[model samples]
Target: MPVTLAIAGLLFATGSNSARTDVDGGRQEELSGLVSQENRKVDAYDQQVERMQREVDRASRARARNDKVAARAQERSDELGRTVGLGPATGTGVRVTLDDAPRTEIGEGNIPPDYLVVHQQDVQAVVNAMWAGGATAVQVMDQRLISTSAVRCVGNTLLLNGRVYSPPFAVTAVGPTDRIAGSLEREPGIRVYKQYVKTYGLGYEVERLTEVTVPGYRGTLDLQFAESGR
Candidate 1:
């Protein structure tokens, strides 16, 4: 009689466990369904926003086309475009490439923590040096530099204009080769970077191009601002 009671207890426990599992699984499915429904709604809303923006842009552009003042404004736009490196430029110049140091055993010295990675100053140093060296037009990666071009770094990657680029950033400029090279050598920031290159295996390369072409700016040049101090 004792053995029979023990077997009956085991069967009852097993049945209870199975029922609990089923209940938990049903709840999980219901939660998943709710999440999926929300995601679908969000997707639909995003599509609606995109369609509205497209319609707005089309309307604005059409108005510009019908206005004589807009046509005259485009003439000045063409001139400003070339001056800001928005128009493609081709010439002989020097190209500078700066890359982060290789991941290896750091050499013995009082090296700062900053030597391990390439910072914005490092990139800016090269760009500024090139401009000072008399670079007619400059480009970071494949994008052309405009009057509004700004070089910025976030973490180890570079943020130029509106795009992000990984290590081994390339800076190309079109102008006198001799002056560009000399400017780079004179830049104090670059000299310090060079010291780390020997210690930490940082990459630095300069190439001279007899003929190279940099594309014009492809982003919006429109400025939107209002007078302050109302």
Candidate 2:
């Protein structure tokens, strides 16, 4: 009779545990669904914000153009004041170049494979440092910089302002060269990069340019936002 009771007890315990696990799993599924729904709502809100900003920019530009035309027609003196001579300008700033480090021999496990390659974050860090050092304008490659532009990397190529570029990226900033250069030198990640430059032939340079002109941002600003129903 004692043995029979033991078997019955074991069966009851096993069944109870199985029921509890099923209940917990169902609750987890419900919670996951709620989180996903919340994320969707947040993403929608961000899209709306970007759309509104574009609309504002477009309206501002239109008003400025109309004002210019009216002033040119009605007031000769005002038009003359608005017109300024376009002249060659020069700025003294620093140029920084970043390239992939040289590959190491695979015989020893001394170095990881990722160590020899350049990353997008590395480029971003340098650019951020320059901006923090009071850079007025910054340019990457042949394209001019803009406030809305984003720099991204896929594999070894960089994507900036709807253009693709290969490595050995050059970033130029118009600012106080001394302060910009100092910022780069003082960054923590740069120390690791210096090691790469010494171990492998990573291309790096900081040169002060006598003249550089960063053009203004040129792109269409279109706005799209969620209407009441849509």
Candidate 3:
């Protein structure tokens, strides 16, 4: 999935070389249109999911009312659901924003173009630091974090949960704000990133929020595994 997403990013970021003389060939604009269209589709699907989930919840509650076993199972499912980020998380925490450095003339000081862009590891560092700081929940862009969630990138754009987002990505977490702030400060990857922020002017900012809510994970939880040959 990650590999496929990376390829999609490449397609969006760089159009066919044989089809055009210029590097981008005005594909950035086309990509923007496609992104907007996909976002609308996602929104529609979310609405459909919400309606179906409400129906399921109502039916579960009805069954639990008359069946002792069903009641116990529903109670257990609710408990586990909260622990696994199936429900919304709300509390005080931090919102960290990362953006690419402004384009500059490639001349003296010999700075690589890569240094000016935010990479996959850069976002992962922040998420991991938040988790290490005891974050109850973390969100990248608008998607809630699950154990299976993967952060990926191609060029300066971010790929999260099958959606592509541009620079100025925001990572929000609900937890102990002070501890998370300290962890962000102490993280080695973040420290190196900060140094680049100082030298190359990359956009890195952390804002401690008094209150924030990370929505429940609405994506599928089914996992696929390979079966061994006998």
Instruction: Please provide TM-scores, in order, for all candidate models, with all chains considered together.
Output: 0.63, 0.55, 0.85
Overall lDDT per candidate, in order of appearance: 0.72, 0.62, 0.83
Give a tens-digit lDDT track for model 2, residues 1-230.
23223333433343344335465776545544543454455446546755785696566556657798744543553343223211122477778899876444422357664566667777887788788777767777755555555677655556554344567899988788888888998876777787877876677888888778765444323322234675
For candidate 3, write residues 140-214 as lDDT tens digits.
999999887778786667766666678899999999999999999999999999988998889999999999999
Query: 2 or 3: which has the higher TM-score?
Result: 3
Sequence-dependent TM-score of model 3: 0.85
Q: Which residues of candidate 2, in runs, are more than 4 Å off?
A: 1-90, 103-111, 220-230
The better candidate by TM-score, 1 or 3, is 3
- Residue 50 lDDT in candidate 1: 56
Q: Which residue window of length 10 is worst by lDDT in model 1?
A: 1-10
Tell me the tens digit of each residue's lDDT in model 1 across 86-179. Answer: 6788889888888877655334345554677788899889989989999888888876776666676655656553444568899999999999
Clash pairs for candidate 2:
none
TM-score of 2: 0.55
